[model samples]
Target: MGAWSRLKEAFTREANISSPEDLLAQARGMRNGKVPVTKDTALRNSAVWACLRLRADLMSSFPIDVYRYVNGIQIEVPKPPVLVSPGGTEVGMREWMYSTEFDLDRGGNCFGVITERSGVIGPDGRGLPGRIELVELGAVAIRGNGSTITKFIINGAEYDPWEVWHEKQYTVAGVPLGLSPVAYAAWVIEETLSAQQFARDWFAGGAVPLAELKNNAKVVNAKDARVARDQFRAAVDDSGLFVHGMDWEYKPIQAVASQSAFIEARQYGASEIARFFGCPGDLIDVAVSGSSITYASMTQRNLQFLIMNLGPAVGRREDAFSRRLVSGPRFVKFNTDALLRMDPEARARTIGARITNRTLAPSEARALDNLPPFTEDQLSEFDRLFGSRSVPAQPTTAVPGATP
Candidate 1:
């Protein structure tokens, strides 16, 4: 078969697997073809670090809350069991979110074991899964194909699909497993690693200095070459001098292009990786010079991030949690306001605008500021101080004409 025909056949074969074991075997075979990029090595790339950190940290910082719908309005309930103590130990909601997001970003999948639950009570009651334990992606395996997940294998133990929670990123048709960004972008990451290694090795090897012996002489054997190399190293190391015949020459290999070329290559790699992960290049410290994109303020940038990057992911999580943890009318939500919090000045401006438009009440604004509503005495004082100024005086046109 021609190369193109073989490539088409491989894709067709992968897309035709209908058995659970066949899907698992295909995933394992693909994984075995290359050294899987571990979380540690992936983080060494600045782009990966920036992308994962920004996403995980921001998502984790948000408050995960449970609420119930009543009369078409949502009311937040007291801390739900899932949100109050997700991992059962020191790991709470924030840590749970962080770990899940980290896994999703690194491995395109997040797995957690749901342990313990309580009978469904009133809308205000706590949600199910009294305790949840995060499972490392490396330790989890998909055991079925198609929409129905039969089981999950964690640490060599088989778990019913319903017993575990799973979140996945990009998925291909006929594949039940999530597709990892690192695996898809392996070539770019490898190039970046190689470039960094080259630079390090270059510096470690005395910056590429070359030496020529007198009269074009050459070492006759490996032992002679070793002795000559040691002598050269000794002279250079001890006195920064090379004792040689008058005809000896020393030269250094200079890069054809400026060092900036290497820097540009690395920068390009970072941008490529950021694109692969659906992150803005600038968020990962990839310079955005000469770009048309601009943000009027930090608030605008955050809003853009929410709409363009995190909106879908947040929706998926909310749906998953609602289906698994809550009963009718009750739903799980992450308070994204926590992530979009503004500076004091910006916050004040927003609140002021809302109040002026009468869309928000003064008491509600005060509550948002963590302050109690004004007491009757305080209200009276406020009236005394500013109420008179707000009330306009009656017009005195006749009196003004008489005075003129």
Candidate 2:
């Protein structure tokens, strides 16, 4: 096909998701003619952005490691240049992971153009993505059936499956495209956004539903009432007080309730957003209600978060990185210990316990504290202070019918 034909085809192709419906159909109650929930629009909702931000920050904080198993022990493998700089730019893997993770958290998918491939090939003769050039989700058009991607059209340029790097979450069994959280949860997000916008407009336009100056005791003529109304409105418009006589009373109908309900809706929406992102409401300051539960310390809270909220997502990322970044038995993993690090006193206690249990060594524990190995003088001091611990050998048992 000609360039124009390819461009037209790229623009005309149907959406990548299954069920073959309009992207915003699930959000039928969306305002302004049921507008679609793009990433930009969804991000305008603070709660949505907060959830995505929380996930992205945590995921990016982890350092990725490539290792191989030897006799069931993980042996650290030197990271290739590609792993260090996946973008083929000065941008390191951490920034790349952050951006891609943010995209995945918001849209359930991330796409990038492969700028270079390594000589080390993976399965199916497709080389590892040596350098990926990240692309905006808006600029990439995925053409495929529900289960498998056929071709990628990025900015009207065609690319094979191996030429692009795609990481997806919220996946279904038969769908090629990941189900977007923003799309599926659009109803809640749009409702929250609409409420926020309404509040802004209400304040900006100075439109009150209950601004009538009612006479409590005395009856006022229509002319006087109109005069009073005009005066009150003019004063309010000028950012002044609506001064009136004691006989007149101004009552608001559900005005306070309306504001309170909006606040409540925001809190509820925040909780829902935290849920959708698999985060603890408290972690994102969503303020869970009426709970007596408490953690002993921040470490416990982080432990709970790692176990219940972030573990599975981290595992999925490890799987993706293992499959795409390397071939053979070598795999990728995130150093999860960073998330569960304890305070200094607690850390010393834990490390001491491990040393007592013989599961850890003094040199290794020193490494955990970023300390160099003990010098001869330091070792002599320790040996002097605490007597040298010499192991006692067990008595040998002579075999009855065999030579000892």
Candidate 3:
């Protein structure tokens, strides 16, 4: 098949399900007095969106490398073209990782079709994919008999397991599918969305009157009451003064305390969503009450974030990539050293310290900054400025007043 044909086969918009059912259910009325919560509806909530986006954003930033073991040693190799442009030449590695990571973060799984394969075949009787095109989560369905997925249905077309690329997280025993944190946190999301809608509607003419105008002297006739109501509404709507004679009373209304706290409730909901997604509340910009963490430097902060929040997910993705994208002892690794990179001043201090202690060579340190090793003339100038690195005479002559 041509590349265009393969691309066509690789991606389809057909979904295993439709989204309007949730929308209709919500529109007709509440389901059991609560808004229906689905992936689509849940994303409308800012907290959920932020939590998922934060993870995907960070996941895509880490560069991936290919490595293989040789004689008890691991060495990095040039990454395959598929890793550089999985979706297409038009889609770079960062975009591909971002798209898949977004799906994995939101749904606990990511699905793609292997559109092309290499000429070399591995022991598994299948070649590594040369191209993989992801489709919408809605476009795929899983068929399993409890223990493992038996079939993959993409765009209403069935395919063998080998043709599909699937990665799953948040898994449990005896279940082929990943358990979605979004699905499990539906109640919190729904409550948050509902609160947002309530506040929106209240501001948009859904609340009780601001004040009631009443006459104490006499009961007004319907004709006069209608005229008076219109006059009052028209005056207030224009923010004009409502002039009235004696015997008229305007009683202002005050909202109950509960109704005025949805803003705070939304903040709390953000913290909850962050927790559900295993994201540090601070990393995702959701503040946890009575919790404060301090770090000495950016490297330390990023290290903590990687270890606590992103380490497991990164490891899981690395495993998936190694299993599916390569063969034999070859493996995939994410370059998290980029995350620990410090500012120039601090980096210089660190490398200088390492070189002084002989833990690292000056040439190796220069390479870390993408610089070539010092030339002979530069080395001679360095020797003059800061004494030679050659060891001092082994104190063959003991210190004048020291014990032997």
The candidate 3 region of ten consecutive residues with least summed lDDT is: 395-404
Question: Which digits, one per residue and each the tens of the lDDT, describe model 1 over residues 251-289?
Answer: 665665735777888988998998877789877678876
lDDT tens per residue, model 2, 1-404: 43223323333545442221133343243333444456778888777887888888888888777889899977878886667988876878888988998988777789998888889988868777789899888777677744567788888888888889998888755556565777667667767887787788676655555445688887899898888888888998998777767778887555677889999998888888777777788877788999888899888999888999788889998998888888899998888777887788898888888867977666666666566556666667757777983322222332121100
Clashing pairs in 1: none
TM-score of 3: 0.82
Q: Which candidate, 2 or 3, would have the higher TM-score against the true structure?
A: 3
The residue-by-residue lDDT of candidate 3 on 1-404, one tens digit each, is 53223222222332332222232333334452557776667889877888788878888888898888788877777787888889887888898888887777777778899999987575568888989989888788765543555678899898877889888887755445565676667767877988988877666647556567899999999998899989988998898888888968988766566475987888878888888887778876776788667899989988988898889999998998888787778899998776788888898888778868877665566566565566666667767878984422222222221110
The model with the greatest TM-score is 3
Model 2's alpha-carbon lDDT is 0.73
TM-score for each of the candidates: 0.81, 0.81, 0.82
Ranking by TM-score: 3, 2, 1
Q: Tell me which of candidates 1 and 3 scores higher on lDDT.
A: 3
Candidate 2: segments with Cα more than 4 A from true spot: 1-36, 206-210, 213-254, 387-404
